[model samples]
Target: MTVPEKRLHEDGDGDGDGSGANDTTALEEKRQNTQPYIKGIAGIKPEFLAPISSLSSTYTEYNDDEAEGGDRDKNGSQNGNGDKRRKKERGQNQKRDLKQKRDTVRLCVSLIDPEDESTPCVAGDEEKCKYSHNLEEYLASKPKDIDGMCPVFEALGYCPTGMKCRWLHSHFNKETKKLIKDLGKLETEKDKSFEVNLIDRESKIALQRKKYKYEISEQVIKYLDSKVQRNDSHQENRKENEATYVEQPFKIAEKKKIDLRGAKIVSPLTTVGNLPFRRLMKTLGADVTYSEMALSVPLIQGHQPEWALPKAHISEHPGFGVQIASSKHWAAAKAAEVIYRTTQHVSELNLNCGCPIDLLYKSGQGSALLDQTPRLLRIVKAMNGSSGDIPVTIKIRTGVKENKNTAAHLVDRVLNETQVAAITLHGRSRQQRYTKEADWDYIEEVGKVVKNWNEKREEDKEGRDTNPTWFVGNGDVYTYEDWYNGVAREGVDSVMVARGALIKPWLFEEVEAQQYLDKSSSERLSMLDKFAKFAIEHWGSDEYGVNSARRFMCEFLSFTHRYIPVGIMERLPPKLNERSPKFVGRNEMETLLSSSDYKDWIKITEMFLGKAGEDFQFVPKHKSNAYENTENR
Candidate 1:
């Protein structure tokens, strides 16, 4: 398979005139200086083979100089200028703003439902209502209907967004002036409950008014206060007699046990792991999924935005886990109690002790818990005592710094101190971040320790309530080989995938097949289309919803665009650390899919959602093209 030559930009702006002719003699001269060849092996689908005329608008031209060591310095800053480039933001954006203002006005909530027209203002009289109830005025100033069928209405038999839907024309009766619904389909499809973990209006109001009771959490906290010594150093060992004497306020109920021996689990990702993405993963073949890590403080305070993190699709149940981060025992206890009381779909409640972001670590949460083992154990104990039958799990890293691995040493303490159901080790220190490869050898050692501890408990004939903790390893499991190798180890039960799943959602499918399947460009596009539809269904079909879906879709593409196709690789399996050399695809669509430019990502989103507004803009969280010096921090 011959590879195409890298196309050069004719101008400095990185946008060149559309041209196809190649100078063979000049290409041959430049071939010796280029990197290894990578070609597109799969055949292109006819429907996705776009015309060259459209390519100019859809594709961002790569600058020839930038691809071949241009004027930029090693720090990715421009040269020959006294002005220095602004350093890119790292970790979480403290000023992250997602408030999307719509270009046009919207109708009042009271007027949205055609069936409930009698109660124009349920909160009060219609004259006192603050929202605009003028339907005629709203329709007149509403943005033009988007050009496609409403994906939510098409699948669910009805659109919940009602008249506010951008695709209003698709399911609206202009003559009757009523939103349409497929009664027959609704009756046939029995389960209308698509999502779970939603706090009711009364519960939310109660929380806001500080009227909701935390009876279980209060009891647990009071008991802990009576027994635990404040200001005690974590290094000081507790007296052996103290362990047998101190009892919890009440006996912990028998919880549902989870066995992750061979399960393929998706890690609790932050921004990208939303409900729509998890639903897409479930369809692809993931056995387990986790919600984005919710902060315990906000959850206990009844903040609606934080509450949205725990909402899960119906298909995710029986394997779904809700993860929460807290620095204090009270917050963890109260949050766990509330989640247990309100949610029926959760299989486990996971405490996050592995998040390495500066914002979390500085706040005495996440990896900071590694240093404060006493506080961490107290938080875990409080959660276990409060969250009735739901299993409790925790995700931790090696330690806080390099060359000081503490996870193996902390294993015995965790086993003896808390009744956690499972332990997931991420195999990297908080300081290590992604600078170096994950230390799986250390993870295996920790796994062995956990396995031995469980065996010793079994041999000692511990009480029936004493459950054996499952050990799962995470980090850098990108392929089927990685999955098999991890599971085949002596003590590791399963693997939890993060960036790998984001790059290839069909990773579980490959694990089942036990071989690499070279996906075509068209197939990948189809996957994106499915995600788009799911996002629309989950977010809504309004202008704001469409843009929200588009923003997230772009985020998904940011990670996926790094995937180097199996067919093109000179080697068998790709390494997470290795970078791909500059290469063009056999076809234009395939080339477009491989683009790292955010502009190109926006162009891809436009393929599903209509053309973005002039004001629509996206700045990726990380600079994918920035050079990394592995030797340094």
Candidate 2:
């Protein structure tokens, strides 16, 4: 109600009598005017007042003009009807804003990006994700991260957007034109030997034909029993005969070690894994290391180079892991068989389904494996058949995107479909690539689901085995303290490190020591030396090798540089450009030997490549900026 009018009426003075209301207003005005003078006596400014909204409400009934008052020029100086017109204009503007939001935001989406794009669209788009290709190769060739996802071929309209097709980019580009652009040279300097053509209808048809021939042949080969070779039809089919072969289930070994107070991490980055690297990690006190990812098709083909990736070093004895990427049952089975035969060093066999790289995702491998659960079951079952004493594992992201986490679904599948050794989860969706946080909460949620699943599995006649697949978490773990925080939680088993380890090899050691061992610059230089020796053995010590080794060293250094933690460096706040903590003397060399850096890495590579070898050329991988979501978040 209008305070003054209500006051007049409440005082038995009718509003019809303008005299009484005016008198009350005059009295209120006099009181307000005297407030400043009274404040001077008390030395207090009249700071407290009734809320404007409430005061305005009380005054509301006094006059309709007051109701329309706020609507007038907000300057509070406008005449009555002016407010009404302004109110109308405000409503119109609000309506317009809403309409704009509806039209533009219906299908808006934010996607995770890779660190590099020049190699392959592991998840689909390159530009959206800032991820580069493989770093080792990038350092070797260009010493720089490139600007594209895939180099050999670019598909037209091949984005993995599915139904959310925005059709925003050029479907194809001429190879020659792109080459000129990439070389950063003028067209006059372009080589004419190779031709580039956009993917047209004719080209697509030819591509389809090639795919049909390849895929159909592969499918047929996989369908045939191993013992059913045409030339050996007359021979005894030992593997295929009913008496010789039977569908069996996976068996999980009891936990050999009792320590369960840590994070269980798994890596989907098998391609970059190698014996030298895994061994180095083990030496560094890492809890575990995954084998480079293996492909089911190549294993079925018995390709020598492909099979070589699964090979374990003599030092990879206890915690070695073998990870495979596959979308078919027989292929998975075949790959597992090859891994087991080549490496007794493995404790776990991981299936990759979190990789968003277009090569793996588009082929129904990696994250694509999440879609065909029944198929995944079949594949895992095949692995179980020949798992032997080793455990079977799986690596995956949360889901495709849009807040969907398939861990709950896949957790159940892993529990019921096949006997798995463990599940390693990278928290971001496959669509996120390495652009966001690793999603620890979701990882915990998955952990809970797995725990619940185990209880149910134990109760079921079919899933009577008490051995549940262990839960392993990965993504963006940088510090030892972060590692402890993650695994020390109830839901986690053990954590895995990728880029963190690459950047700081001494992380595990630091955690084990329970104190920071900040290495000096000279000490870091020494670590690079050891890495060089390892690289030499892997790449050979020739000129063709040395240059390549130098390049990869730089790559390793790039990651290593990120590890200089804040506390140890006596130099207050640490900056990448600032000097790292120096050892008291040269005595800190051992600590430095445990670290990494591109410069030291190259120095190390020099030992192997003869100091003259050129670096391998390719793309760089991206580190996710979504630290809060995937790791810290």
Candidate 3:
């Protein structure tokens, strides 16, 4: 299915009224031009497409002129595809490179003067301490404490950042010069609100020191090497020794089972898929969530940022999966083993073979693995052998290039060669990216093959593993109709929502209701408000924390601003790629919510995260200067 180009509505407000709307001939032409390719399976009602003003009694009325024009880029003329792309690229400042770390005075935790009087500073030798122990000097150099109570301390009962926290005045007593704490609340909320999968100091030290054991990984590698050498022998000898060749040291059934049939999964979006966002997805009814892809080399080197990817909220358990990308078996096995040993919250260890970024692809990771099936198989086998009681899964695309699809052939090889618990097939090839529509037909074709393999496994269960491997379909699932349709497809066990969920987080809620929900702008704002609160809880409410939350919030807003309200659409079901013409919303707030300007996103964040300081700036990863009317060109 292809996305139809949007036709410019000269004077119509899209409410099926006014001069353009009254032209029944023009309306018919528009409908015929932009008809949906995939028919709705969930019995989509025609009334659902009615304007918001007619559907909702509480909707604020506005002038037709107010709905005519929005914030359209002057340079964005819809002359051609090149011009449209240029207009879209105008929303982003591609060269806005901001320094990650700020120049600020920070004090060590040991010299912070503990809230508990009985506790002594860990740094006994004051002069030998690496960090500044001169509390008075450090305090004088520190910027004034930010106003307002620290949301982290208020919610989580304690501030892990302590004296270094930018909102230090909230918990500090001026006269006594002592930090304050809610000791009772701290004890109760210790394990509840805190994030899981934190590697212990000892474990980190051992890994860095090269003292961490890799017995299981070493054994697995040794076995794989022996098999490679044995392949040089005669066919009869190889067949005779097949029984003695152990693929894995343990059984696949012993690992935690992943049941994804008819489940709603949130894709592990890079940068945007943080702990707070996943937590928000859980509230919206996501059945499964994955951590952002971690680099195996960094993970093996005990990198904190890579390790942070595995940290999940308490609510994510039994469904949270940690994903890692690697090109080699040693790196993959060691990374998987470390994560399995350190984290009890992980349901499955997923190998990311679908990332199409040039950096990862050039490094022989991500989509590069698709071309090297043997290496990919070895990596999966090694992960299974090393990762105790943790199910291994893989996410792949149709192929590395357009026209030439290999996922079906690769699926057969993967099912026969490895003990993967689940396989997620993204319907787009690496070459396709977002330039074209996802090939769901190809996804279903692969899913059917997996189904056949699983059925055969069920029929002959002796000696071979009997567990049925699940097949999940990913790409371009935007609405409840799209979700239900994908799941109803032959052999597709579930669907993974990515950009769709980012744009409308309540998508899962809609899927559960099995209908279109024309949520008010206020309702959508409330969801963003909840996200801000969750972000503060996870990242803290101090200056650094607030900035972190604000930055990510802006990242979220970058995608969310694309949601053209269902009520304003001329058709029944909205396509994910359909670019709407600049049109006003039911209210002023709604208009702001649908803005493509990055500045408007900042204004939205200011409502929840307080004013972004002069030091703060946000540059969207993608440009979004929506098309302007041709007359303006």
User: Global lDDT of each model?
Assistant: 0.74, 0.47, 0.73
Per-residue CA lDDT of model 3 for 1-633, tens digit only, reads 123333333222122212323333332333345433212111122333224332221111111100001111123231212345743433333344444344255555575555544545556666666667677777786666666777678776677767766677888888998778898999987777768888988888888888888766777766665455244556666555554665644443367778999888998777778888899899999999999888898888888877888999998987999989999888998898898788888999999898776566777888889898988998999899889889999999889988889999998999988889999998877765554567888899999999898888877857255567899999878888889888878899999998889888999999988878998999999999888878988876556777888888887787788787777665556666544434567788988897666677778987887777778856654443222223311
Q: After superposition, how far is residue 438 of candidate 3 from its true place, in Å?
A: 1.6
In model 3, the worst 10-residue window by lDDT is 63-72
What ranking of all candidate models by TM-score puts the best one first? Answer: 1, 3, 2
Candidate 1 lDDT over residue span 116-157, tens digit each = 656467547667776667888877776778788888888877
Once model 3 is optimally superposed onto the true structure by TM-score, how far is the C-alpha of residue 240 displaced, in angstroms?
A: 17
- Per-residue lDDT of model 2, residues 1-633, tens digit only: 001111111111112222334433433443365422210011111222223332211111111111111121123322222355743432211111101011111221222112123435544664554444342232243222212332111221122221122111122233321211222332332331121111234423433343312322233224334323344554565444534435322233343331323633324333334455565666677666666666777655655555566666555545566667787666676555545544455677777776665556667887777777766776776676554556777777788763777777877767765576678787777655444456788888888877777677788897774565577777656556557656754457778776666656777876676545666655565666566545544543333333444555554544564444433332221211121211222234333332322233334443333332232331222111001222210
Candidate 3: pairs in clash: none
What TM-score, computed on C-alpha atoms, does each candidate reach? Answer: 0.83, 0.53, 0.79
Ranking by lDDT: 1, 3, 2
- Global lDDT of model 1: 0.74
Best by TM-score: 1
Task: Please estimate how well model 2 matches the true structure, expressed as its whole-model Cα lDDT.
Answer: 0.47
How far does residue 91 in candidate 1 sit from its true spot (Å)?
A: 11
